[model samples]
Target: TKMRSNGRIQLHSEDPHQLVFEALLNRGTPGVIAVDDFVLKDGRCDNETYGTCDFESDTCGWQLHNWERVTSQRISLPATDRSTRSPSGYFALAKAPGGRMVSPLKWYHAAKHRCLRFWFFISGTSSERLNVTSVVDEDQEKSLWYGAASEASIQQWFSASVNLPAQEKTPMVVFDAATSGNPGSAVAVDDISLGNTPCPPPGSCSFDEDTCNWYNAGDLTNAQWYRHRGATVSNLTGVQLDHTLGSKEGYYLLLDAEDTSARSLGSMQSEALTLGPAVCFRLYYVMRQNSGASLSVGFLDEHHYLDGRATTVKATTPSQWTLLQVERTELPPMFTIIITGRTEQGSSDIAIDDIDVRSGRCTTAETDPEASMPPTTEADSPATSHVTEPMPSKQPAPPEVVTWQSKTTAAPATTEPLPPVVCKRGEFKCRTENTCIPGSLLCDGVYDCLDGLDEKCESGAQCKENEFFCVTRTPSACQPRSMLCDGQEDCVGGSDEALCGACPAYFC
Candidate 1:
């Protein structure tokens, strides 16, 4: 069952209405389980509630931006250079006090549901002080939250409208950045983008044209970082490899096809390349046995056809060059990534290049934070996207450097140990979705919390005083689950669960 190309190509920005689908895996690939780059290095994840890794800032080396679109003029937008962070401070627009804020790929330690946005840049006199938080899964003190900032160089875009509740006492949404009047000024932040609102080319979802060509199931090509995409021989000098790294050090576009018409879907010349929001794909050909061959890789925006055509996976391994990855959401804005070698009953040879195009992560759930958001609601939220609207109140940025004394790393978690709590009620305020046990109620059965863990039980089923039944069988209902953990599974597994219940007492 190994014939997947995920067929994708979607990442559009000048905002046509936003669409999404071309993917790259903040993590995913052939065998991709490669962990242990291990940098929390001296003791962490021992799991206190996941808040360690003093690697602090400088973010591993940065570079991890699959996508983002919060608005506030990231200066000149189009960015993708990437960074989990670089710091200094000064920003505003309030409202962000919980559900996702740790840092560095995989979202440091917390992020559930996803979709929170922000960005701030400043020019100085803004002495420093910024601390915004979002810790959902690594739950210490219940999903924390914070927010605050004075001003300088100023540019802003803060939003939070959905997806929190992965657990950790749940309520860690904090922000408190401070600044004086002009001391150093150079605070940049391209952060806090929670998800959903990604279309109009927001990742190139679909285009549909197929006779003149316009097939974007999501594949616009341009992953170009380490460089890799259907290469028969990147630079093996002349072609050497037999041992893994010599001869041809790294070259593999090998798939010996003989039937299935030698499946071929490489070049359709739909304008010579420029159609990937997802069309369709197929690689790895094999039909070289009784002259009966197979080779495939076909996509159709238009060159003649009538029904969803894309074949090349009929009898399996023709000798293997197979590595087909597609994402398919129906993109046809001029499509063609063909390579078809067909054989109804005779000669076949299916051997194609190494065409790689994978990138997808765009959806978390949100619907508020001031104008310009229509990346995906199916449609209807883009009254405007060049971004313009703030005269009613909370959207008047571009001023701050009101100094007092400071340094920078966004200069204001102060090193953090936790416990400051002011979190917006709305003085033009913001921040408040770490909701562990405030006013947002509905956990029934009793014990609002002297320490019943929040009610509802099952596994060991105890009813000490509030009707404890740790055995709702497991569907106990918590709303937004998955702090990881579901091997054989159970609800909201937070430390991946092992403190007592849902099977981790030492397996099966």
Candidate 2:
């Protein structure tokens, strides 16, 4: 027997074979179980629903009966066109702001291979926000997916997958949608299921889509790395990585530490990696220098053990692409790579790209002294560094200087008065923080201030009249409306694209 193009099965044999085929079909093939598909029957939403709304459960199974805020007579369907419905209809959150829908809880034996899959529709002027969370345990709720408001011309369907943890029972899932009070702000969901398959982590990210699961910590408010493709930068000297035009590669991660206050320290970490027998990590980095700026790269073991190497280049080290490589032979249960940058004043513009984490070990057994440094008193540290000025024209570019010792020789303390700070070319002083930042960054999308003053520019005031305001952008700077939803994040927190369905834009 074979499947025909006309959508029928052709049985080459007769009655005896038909009996056997029917029996085999009845037994069926083992596959993923259908947990919940969110299908509505007879266009009716009633009490015995797989998904229940927060409002009256008897009136609607998967959606709110009415807008709690508005007195409208018409009931809203998840989508305008019934043809787009997954089966007949889908569960849409209430149109009113803060609407929520809870999926019925289910019990499942926990294993590493258990995974969740779902499809959702997002569209309208005030595209609604959707949050998908899994309740692994009472206190341990994990956010598996988040989608921002979108402004697409038509409804869009997105399929998402999430990997469940290795061991746990009573796993339940929930879908919540936020409303914007506009018909265009519609959030609908369908096709949710569970399977015995694990989702694999991305082996690399080029800053092409979000931060690729990297999280930021340390000095988050005033200093940190941001995904850079196009947008401007400030307070930079010498040859700095292109903030808007991009690096040698089109997109890269940037840390604009130049022009900040006294001391700025920040780090970006990758998602947890379940290592193979061995692992090797490689990345390319470029750093513009200042007197006290330094960058460190390391990995955190499953035991929260930090093994890192710190290196500081000369103040005049040429800004060019440099490859940094490291590997670990003895693999652990899980580990994450962390890149930390430190600077006194804003003197570093660092860019990183082509992060490749693969299954392999280092070519050579290289020992990092900083990785094994014992905790010691700062008083026993090496003497402060005394850098000599390089001769103009006669001085050739010096090689990058890496300090792997656990303890770095501190720069001599300054006794001279902290004079009125000066900003570099094409920069301005954040009078409040006394940090100089780029003119383009003044209102590009990020808040570049400690007092939150940078984002305070009014649309018709500090921000150009023609520019649009990212209400949530720190320092709430102005950006040309053309940059909004043009496929690249121009606003610091990515508020520019939030209304177009990209979300939680990265900011330090």
Q: Write the per-residue lDDT of candidate 1 for residues 1-508, one digit (tens) a residue.
A: 1122111112223555543224334322222222223232333233223322222232222222321223234433212212222232212221211122234445322323332334344333324434444444554332222223332211222211222334333344443333343433233344333333211111111111011111111111101101112322222112223111222344222322211211121122122222345322322222333344433333433211111323334333323222333334454443334343333322342333223222221223332242122111112111111111111211112112101111112334335443323211100101233223321121345554455543332322232333322111112223222322233223211112222333322235
Quote the lDDT for 198 in model 1: 19
lDDT of each: 0.27, 0.44
How many residue pairs clash in all the candidates, one count each? Answer: 178, 12
* Candidate number achieving the greatest lDDT relative to the actual structure: 2
Backbone clashes counted, model 2: 12
lDDT for each residue of candidate 2 in 1-508, tens digit (9 for 90 to 100)? 1101111111233345322212222123221222223332344333232222222112233323332311112434343222123233323445556665544444345655454545555554333567666676679876655654331212334444455556556555566667666754566555444545343233344554344445463222335577665332543533334322334335667766552432255567665465544666655556554345555555554322342222233333445444455555655545556676665545556666656666665454443321121122223111221121111111122112101110112322344233445433223346677765443444445676677555454332556656876432222335577876676544333445544542223332
RMSD (Cα, Å) of model 2: 21.4
- For residue 345, give model 1's deviation from the true position in Å: 41
Tell me how far the alpha carbon of residue 254 in candidate 1 is from the true structure, in angstroms, after superposition.
Answer: 20
List ranges where model 1 is wrong by over 4 Å: 1-123, 134-175, 180-188, 191-224, 227-508
